[model samples]
Target: MDDALVVGGTRFIGRHLVAELLAHEYDVTLFNRGNHDNPFAEDGRVDHVEGDRTDDDALEAAARTVDPDAVFDCVAYHPADVRAATRVFEDCEAYVYVSSGAAYGREDIPKREDETPLASCTAEQATNDSRDSYGNRKAEGDRVVFAAADDGVNAMAVRPPIVYGPHDYTERFAFWVDRVRRFDRIVVPGDGTNVWHRVYVEDVASALRVVAERGEPGEAYNVGDRRIVTLERMIERLADTLETDVEVVYAGSRELAAGGIELEDYPLYRDHPHIVSTAKLAELGWESTPLSTAIDRTVAEHLESGRDGRGQGPCRDDENRVLAALDYADR
Candidate 1:
């Protein structure tokens, strides 16, 4: 059996990737802190190894024991993390690094796999900053992983945009869903004209699996749905799905930024024209799930979970203040 080791396999995209790998008949070993229960415990194909990827000694010990044919690094953030992994698994057959589209520094350029001028920041500075530091760190991480690849050890990176689905913790899209379900008046940032590229979590998982099977060594692929949707249209679609009538209100980006409202806090900001092209992945025979279908499935699953109890509850005093401030500022 071809053995695979997945770091950070207990959550979100990592869980889905592990499932896909098992389905493809790859013997899987997962490494995490094991604080969270394995969602795939019943699958019976996974071997669990508990360790911290940041801990060199622990990671080296786990890598020696698993000695996997390939390593799918699902949660490498800092460039130092990549350097740490290289120290441990220098001889692994394949090192698949899960990177982000944020790696591309050019806000002027719609992100593509082959694009140059990759954004990067020193690892030390990245640790303190939040907003743009993530992409910068990921770019550095990608560089380290690709540089560390060898003739025997193939390395590849996957850059995915806003991934959403069942276990989504970001709740970025969920905030919109909840809002649309309650009120017909939708408040958007910056004319709701930003173009967003979103991919279903399942599609992202499938793409990773395909890349593991056939992706070229030392190449990076952008995996996302090609269809672009504006913030207004996305909300409209959500309203249509929920059978709700809503009014769309647009706000300037400057106003929202000045009010200290984070773009991630609202759905509209995600629509900004930072679109990514998947031409390379398409050539690799990867297909993406339709945006509408993905949205429908996600909303339905989120509603059915009924974990949305918080949506209907009374807003706390501070929460109400923030919402009121946002509304006042936007208006």
Candidate 2:
């Protein structure tokens, strides 16, 4: 495909994916709400269609306007969103649905693309803070594209675990990075050994591109670093990257009960082992960034980017109060 339409491309993973698409010599057109500033706004090489994803008419118009060879659905959450996409890009040759590993749900074992049992999704669930609902919806979205195969939409779902890198809006990794940078002590909100597997934001973009360009339709691929890092090791890697021996404190669920702190507080804080097997996607010739290397790069990029206006952990007061209570208990 010579032309690719990115459903959204002005932020973290989407931004990096746009860069990758451009580097690969594909003409790019972006469809977004135009709320965020895109660095490529003035570049002639890119085209833009401004509208909300939920605005089905706008989406259909953009898809018809671009008439791309491939469409990358970056922000589809609900199955209705997927249905909206099918109606919009009816003529597009290839479809890449950027689903999440969350769709795989909390299986007792590590997830492989083909084996893990998936949950169900709904409109209300997709928009809420519930992980199960989000995953269920993402999974359902994947099914939407797969089921649309009879209509000739060549689609594949790219499921990702925690995606961390520069320009992340979620501040999942930023919580730890920023806390470590600003304070002598950091409170990790879990038992500190919860299993985690994260893919770099750029790595995710690259993987998505690979799927768009070469993936088998109706199939889903799991992509991430093979190395599993615990939430504790994750923080330590930030310290290691910054060359600071920050004091570490572990405040599991009980301690954080008062602060409305959930595992989501730390991006890598998984409810269970979310380690992903990249073997399926690896066969397509894409690779995930190394854990330590990716961490160091993220910390460096976050630091170089002024680290301002990014996310931080819970308010200092809340963290401090928890830390103080723990310290008193220790004494």
Give lDDT per model, in order: 0.77, 0.81
Per-residue C-alpha lDDT of model 2 across residues 1-331, encoded as one tens digit per residue: 8999998899888899999999999999999998998989898999998889988888878877888998988988788889878767766778888989888755746688888767776667756656457778888887888887666778778989878888877776777788788889888867788887788888898898898777987889987876777878877888888888888888887787555565466556666676778899999999877788888888888887765423444677777788878887889
Error of 2 at 60 (Å): 3.1
- Once fitted onto the true fold, the runs of candidate 1 whose alpha carbons sit more than 4 angstroms away are 126-131, 150-152, 253-272, 306-331
Which candidate tops TM-score?
2
In candidate 2, the residue pairs with backbone N, CA or C atoms under 3 Å apart (3 or more residues apart, or in different chains) clash, namely: none
User: Who wins the lDDT comparison?
Assistant: 2
lDDT of 1 by residue, 65-165 (tens): 99988888987878888878865777776778898988888865467778656786874745654765898988887887678764345778889987877
Q: lDDT value for candidate 1?
A: 0.77
Lowest-sum lDDT 10-residue window in model 2: 305-314
Candidate 2 residues lying further than 4 Å off, grouped into runs, are 122-132, 254-267, 306-312
Estimate the TM-score of every prediction. 0.86, 0.89
Q: How far is candidate 1 from the true structure (C-alpha RMSD, Å)?
A: 4.0
Q: Residue 219 CA error for candidate 1 (Å)?
A: 1.0
